[model samples]
Target: MTSPLLVGFLASFALIAAIGAQNAFVLRQGIRREHVLVVVSVCAVSDLLLITAGIAGIGAVITAHPQMVTVAKIGGAGFLFIYGALAARRAMKPSTLAPAQNGSARLISVVLTCLTMTFLNPHVYLDTVVLLGTLANQHADSRWLFGIGAVTASVVWFFSLGFGARCLSGLFAAPMTWRILDGLIAVTMIGLGISLVVS
Candidate 1:
């Protein structure tokens, strides 16, 4: 039998490793070297809190209120669609890829966008709160350990994604490459948005 800690780590890793809006956004920021620390911190901390909440049984509360899920889905979809449109525009008017842009964005805006990406996405709740929580509870006495393991995976993954993206800096130096990446991000966000609404 798999240990609960290992189970939790692997489960969380699998869910988060998939390409999605959050990951794409992180990669973009990481490449740009813009607020990478803030982005990574927000994502890691948010995951920690959500995972802890799930283990502490907050998942049940979320589940009990189905309307909450609907609200999140609609709101998340709208945000994602708008974000996607913005990305599409960026792709169309490709800008030179630089480590830092001419003028950096405000810290507040970056934080707010990161929060929206984390909290608004309904899938995040489903994966971290419901699925992970349910799995952790299956461990019975070892549930907290499972939660810790899951949180560890989240922290590790985000830091790696956020920092590791710099290795691709050389590749993204070309304006066309930046355009392609933005285009891909746009597709991913819009695709996820559509799925959230239809599902």
Candidate 2:
């Protein structure tokens, strides 16, 4: 029998494997070891919501609304482009010393940054809610199973990203590392944006 848990786990991991702004931000936080839990929680919760929405038949509505999708795409594309540019610029600038302790403020900032990165990028909705939803429906035995799998995936992904990034921090510490990451982000954002506009 096909285990919903297994399906969900694999699907979620597969989807998140594609590196994006969220992943980038998560990695940075992991390296810094700052507010990691808060960031992961926000990302996990956001994914859960999106995945639920997808499995609840909202995916069809989104797919049917090409106009709405187009608008979202344009907005997402623009946001990504600007965000990428900013990351690149920051990479070019000299790194500043780490800020003094402020746990409350840091936590809030992590949550908000994650929320903005996830919510503002309409592509996230499309990918998690619409695409994943449609895919789940195809494989799910029932709606409940779909939801179960989807949520499970979110939990697994967030924890993995939050902790796993720390393992690679050493490699990412090099000055050239930030430049490479920033450049990749910029290219990805621009490419995605242009693709959305053209399509």
- What is the per-residue lDDT of model 1 for residues 123-180, given as tens digits with 9 covering 90 to 100? 8888899889999998999999898889999999999999999999889878888889
TM-score of each: 0.95, 0.82
Candidate 1 residue-wise lDDT at 38: 94
Tens-digit per-residue lDDT, 1-199, candidate 2: 6776677667777777687778877876776677888888888888888888888888888788867777777777787777767766756754621222212335766787788778866677778888778777877566557667777777777778888878876776676775676677667767766776777
Q: RMSD of candidate 1 to the true fold?
A: 1.4
lDDT of 2 at 124: 75
Question: Candidate 2 versus the native: TM-score?
Answer: 0.82
Measured by TM-score, the strongest candidate is: 1
Clash pairs for candidate 1: none
| Poorest stretch of ten by lDDT in candidate 1 | 94-103
Candidate 1, residue 133: Cα displacement in angstroms equals: 0.6
Query: In lDDT terms, which candidate is top?
Result: 1
